[model samples]
Target: MNFKPRFVALLVTLAVLVGAAGTYIGMQYFGDPGGQKQTANADQGAQNFGSLSEEEQKEFLDKVGNTDLKKVEQAYSVIKDNYVKDVDQQELVEGAIQGMLDKLDDPYSVYMDKDTMKQFNQTIESSFEGIGAEVSMVDDKVTVVAPIKGSPAEKAGIKPNDQILKVDGKSVEGMELYDAVLKIRGKKGSEVKLQIDRPGSEDLLTVNITRDDIPLETVYSDTKTVDGKKVGVLEITSFSEKTSDEFKKALTKLEDDGIEGLVIDVRGNPGGLLQDVEEILKQFIPKDKPIVQVEDRNGEKSRYFSELEKKKDYPITVLMDEGSASASEILASAMKEAGGYDLVGTKSFGKGTVQQAIPMGDGSTIKLTLFKWLTPDGNWIHKKGIQPTVKVKQPDYFYTNPVEIKVALKYDDTSDKVKNLQTMLEGLGYDPGRKDGYFDKETVDAVKAFQKDAGLEVTGEIDEKTGGKIEEKVVKEVRDDKNDLQMKKALDALFK
Candidate 1:
């Protein structure tokens, strides 16, 4: 993750798309200014970036072709001088930058104006207040990549891939990624209402989340006992500045305590510094192979390797899911490929390119995609995520939707809401009989049993209150450690 800066910038992005994702970032630099004939030493571990020497500046400008800039200037003049009304010249300039980025069609590549750039830098240097979730621009929609573990977004049931349609009653359709994120982020204690469009659901959901000071600490350590053996579980919520060091301490303590195996859980980690993941990978991966490979625009590659001569003696397993992304993916891929370990859970959130934030000489910044990161085995898992060796999906109730009660759901009623309630009932051991959205006689009996056990009215019909209680219980069950089948699978995989 350490880039030898070549004066001109191109780099491994240590930061998130900022406002879109709560993941933090730091500036990194590397470059190949083009114009010159770039040679490929594909096997080389280090690269001399296409010589950014003084003599090449003219060649670089010549290669850029002045015709495009001339055309842009022509358009600016036509609009500014002959338009219907006066225009903010600065706005026009900003629009030109944004327009060029839009043509690239890369959501990660964005323009951060003066104020936005300041806030973005501040977020990385310290902390900010928000709903604690990582979002991305997918198919032109602002979609939730993953909610931060234990954040308000996760507490409010904001799942990955939820397309945010509005924020605080305002439609964000066609809004820029930063603008949309700004609307969502606010001071702690302020409330933000989100209208979400989730896949596989019939109705759009409105989630009310109160913003809070998103936690900066990224690592959590604990122990799990399985089959009379102590196993250490390190859950990385994200890979921030202190993550790698924190991870080292946790691992050391676990080792000192004499653990049989380890579970590296990156289930809901959106992502952070690439360097942090690389630093962690060195602990487990042998030095024989490169930890990861970086491919630049000219198709030349730079291989990065760890100096470790040996791997850990104890068995290791990586736990991941759809919410796992970027640096999280890097760690999981390295463990599976180089360390010869097992991975448990569903596929990962694929984001393979690296970015660099370049100052535009005016307090503005252009966060540009610079390189594509390949796995140790040379796999580019861009849109295609890494598949787990052992895929374990959570219980059906965990993915169920909240019931929207317009009227009481009686035995004759049949709807998606009823089906969700049935799944919840079944998950909690209430024999709902059928789960196909049909509220049959068996479902009624199941509801009655649940109601009686909970000391409710036992009406045999699902009212608003009843549905709310059922949803609450379902969420609780989903959170319970005993019900975490994926963790169990990951731990078992370690032994296997």
Candidate 2:
């Protein structure tokens, strides 16, 4: 997955900067309560504010208390005298208001004028009507880092690493990130054109995507075997609603399969709901075990406890990387502190700040940093991420191939099973170029060449409809090789 800064990091920075600005402004305006003339000055300022033109009003508001009335008047006079183009007074006033808020430097806090503000509120409720994809600026261009799983963008074939150059035929150059988001999001059923550049493709790709309601799924799981141990792999993609439920199902599958161990893959997962994470903890922890604690502004600490009565007995290993953030770190920390689990992979993307999405009366919302969270043992995994118990880097041999193979036939390159087949192929003797894990032309050629040598149809593709044909031939060739030891172990465990 593409790595980027976590959203929570930006939120915390914005909150601190904006809060300081608010404090400063409060001190300046309400510093002296004893001066009756202050009231008179405020009323006079309000009156003058109503009389000025848009640009003049903005200039007046900005210099209101900093300078005397004469200076304010002079500033407005200059703007009116030297203006080159006609400007809307209301827009100018709004822009000045926004400028003041922007000075706070909080990405989450801003004056969203009535229109944009409404859409902001919808995002917090998670009920936005638009193409569901998280976008950001990378290398000065708008890029789709990841389409929310099962969202319209994902359903429309948008993938991570796709560069979005244009939206609705308009270039995204010079457009603010917020503005670009607003333009891409719209009422449901509406259509938007995205000019995308996919990785390894030479030309730009155009995709017409329709907007739809995007409901986030925080948890997803599937059962698989590793070394014949009936290992269950549950991927908690994010911490959102239904996460605990999904986790329960994963545990149920393990129980049904009578698996001896499990692996939870949390790589590339940016966090969401905190309550969901706490609930998930209950499954692995015993009742009354402390999961985490949060201390609020008044120095009061709230402890979250696990409600699980009995813990799963299977040995568990957690897979994490830099993309595992926030609530993900919370869960990983708890599992490590509680013991019985081994963490494998890189350090987590640390983001311990908790943000409250406070909705304005209008449609917009403010994600305010409420409190910083800590593990039950009081370990602060904020900027410094959690260290894994067994850190293992992905093997480089998975990428580089020593030789290239040619084929006598063509195969379906778009089948979903191609990736798994490529992995299986690499496990055998046939070299299929780099395993970026796609059945590209190289993989297809290798497969066709293998098929021709095995006295099978020269098609390079493996289809479920035609399976067991290639597997029977391919598996027989290297069935007794030392390299096939892992596959034998997996098959033996399944049979046993």
Candidate 3:
């Protein structure tokens, strides 16, 4: 499935960066927020012609002959006369509009129906009632990009890259992402069953999740005493309308706690509002510093700048992974350039384009990619994601299956799975040295510490009991920080 940024797009995995000057195409004056007739006029011209009688059709055609609309009229008349069944004129018109945009082959560009438009707006506003998860159309399959931390999907063991084989026992093969999401999300306390396919495993996994009200609290932070140094960890889940305010509150509280360093975690963060990111960056970046640069189709360039003069001088690190994209990338790139922060974790999702959600006069909306963004250093990391200064990749099973170690992992063992154990250890407050995949002396020591704490035989080897304990620790810490490996590295770098 395609990796979608969390905020700028749809709720079930789509994100857009809305920063630079947006050219609004169609602005509707007034309508009910949840009204169905909001998109009625988008294709009304063709629909009106389709409803006319043979003589009236010709007259209408003649009336529009002097304009470019005659071409559309001719096509509609042909379809009306030759189609086997009586077609829904409005549907035909909407389909034509969608087809036109489809020809562009841009995933970010989409024609949203009234309901979709409403839902998309709700997501941007940062409040929704659903089973929190980011999903996207990956290879035409409904795939799970990442479950929101503390969300029902995450609690149900839904992992990144898990394909949706069925929803509520209904096969979702070849289903559009937006449509599938609509079916999956419902009122609070409602149940949604999903059949999952993790890439490396052959057996399908089923998860029954209960939907709830996913809050708009995008930023979370707390101070931790690491190696006698005051360290603040700020977790950014998604950049939403409320993200900037939340970030400020978290930062202020951390400052009050007298933190000397900071870590910003954006792992599995699909990204949110671009302006929200820009506003958050203002607190860190110096006034007048370039935050991000955007280039339009005509080669016109615009740079967004920070507005705050007061800046924090603490050493900072950012945590990221393949699930981070768009606004998250913007924040990571800008901070790395302007604030001299080091990024730890694997490369990001690499979405560098900007999209605008232009509301049509009716209820529908056309979300189109209007420009490409560049990092403060003028780097375009589209497709090729932003690589971390310190590259750390978690074990595959860390995402697919956190529990149930298939093999006995002892000291000197080397594999991606070992790295997974190390990551979990670090999250549970044990220092596993480094997430280097190789089981070194530090890893053994950390494992032994964990075993002793769990009332096990204090064995350095990761046996079944040891592995189960590690999984429990990891599951608990995951909601606190999006990615355990990245967060551990950030803390280690600051304290050690």
Candidate 4:
């Protein structure tokens, strides 16, 4: 025998012997060594390769790489033995799967456990009772941005910008947002007490509300003018059911008003009902134009188009702010793409992902992001906001001064003006009860009575004309006291 050939044969036999021993050891310690036998068998069924083809090698490697049932069983056994706490084997397995999914770090990608999955399914098919408020955590506090109109939250007098301090006597501090929401929401007729704090108030307010079914309505419109232009201002708060019908009515009113322009205010509106947005856009966009495209998993794509014909003839301006989001952005983008519309105010709050409310078997649902939306112009406004074409800021002092006078009253305060007015009214036989700075009912009554007696319009309004007469009377009476600073200041302010 050739020593080289003999030595090679011995080495090959030794390698096979070692593999056999290792397999036996794995089988003895672990469970079934043949657990993956079917997989290995199927992989080995592949035939011939061209000069040890890459495909053949891959198939071979895949078959033997992790196919040893014994080794896999041993690995699981090791984990069970080494795990520090008593673990539910099923839970461990599910947790592992969930952990893998969590690596995606997507808020939408979730593993619904048995109970959660059931709840999610149920929420989709039927209405579940809950407090009618869309609540969110802002700056670590539960804040109510808006109470769903006509919902229990609104009925209970919950207003936007209210900070919830406690829910049902439990402090909400450091609680998870969803957990807080769940606690607040319950079956119909269930009552929950909320401790809230509102701005410009000194005391914490408590409100008790009952859970109820909340139906979200989408489109709302009213005829109003902007800049004396007599334009129809359609405020589409959200694209919901009946939105298209509402839009049609608004359009008809605009036509009847001889409106030449339109201002669609989408400020502070969250999106709803994709179909409603599509239908509303029909009033502005031409039919057959692509409105939006949703690209989902598996590389599948779906496009929504405008089926609109009778386009409204008007100069369109969309008013938007940071609070305007979702369906609002869709409508705004569509109008922009259709051409001849101006976007005003601040950039929008960009939420460009599409979420589907998937109902579990239980009475809860999970809103998961199934796809992302892109504007017809190919703009992705997910985290980045939509920019306005013409930015208009509200003046800070707009509400500081009196815009209108619905009622008028007289002052009898100790302030020099009040004292002078009182003394003058008394001299004129229009006795204002006291010279106090307070504007009491007696003072108002006396002013009205004086207006009536003087044959002046009994509006009880202390306007420039009435004030002038009162000042003249006071000056004539007080001319001897010329050095009065208070009287001079009061007169200066009133005259100016």
Per-candidate TM-scores read: 0.89, 0.53, 0.71, 0.50
Question: Regarding lDDT, does 2 or 4 come out ahead?
Answer: 2
**Would you list the C-alpha lDDT of every candidate in the order shown?**
0.76, 0.54, 0.68, 0.53
Ranking by lDDT: 1, 3, 2, 4
Native-to-model Cα distance after best TM-score fit, residue 133 in candidate 4, in Å: 3.2
Residue 261 Cα positional deviation in candidate 3, in Å, after optimal superposition: 1.3
lDDT of candidate 2 over 1-496, digit per residue (tens): 0111122222222322222000000011000100011111221211322344686545433533334434434644455456797665544544444454456444323344455544443443354567766554445566553455556775555654467778889887766456666667677888998888766544466677888776545556656665656666677765555667778877787678787776676765656567777777887877555788785655567877876777677677777766566677888888888644667777876566664443332333333445668887887787688988776544322222111123222243443244445654665556777455566778877777667766776667654322344444344443333433322232233233
Runs in model 1 deviating more than 4 A are: 1-54
- Write candidate 4's Cα lDDT for 299-328 as tens digits: 466777766675666666777766566677
| Model 3 ranges with Cα > 4 A deviation | 1-69, 287-289, 308-311, 394-397, 402-483
lDDT of 1 by residue, 228-301 (tens): 89999999987766788999999999999999999999997777777888889998888998788889877889
Model 4 lDDT vs. the true structure? 0.53
Which candidate's lDDT is highest? Answer: 1
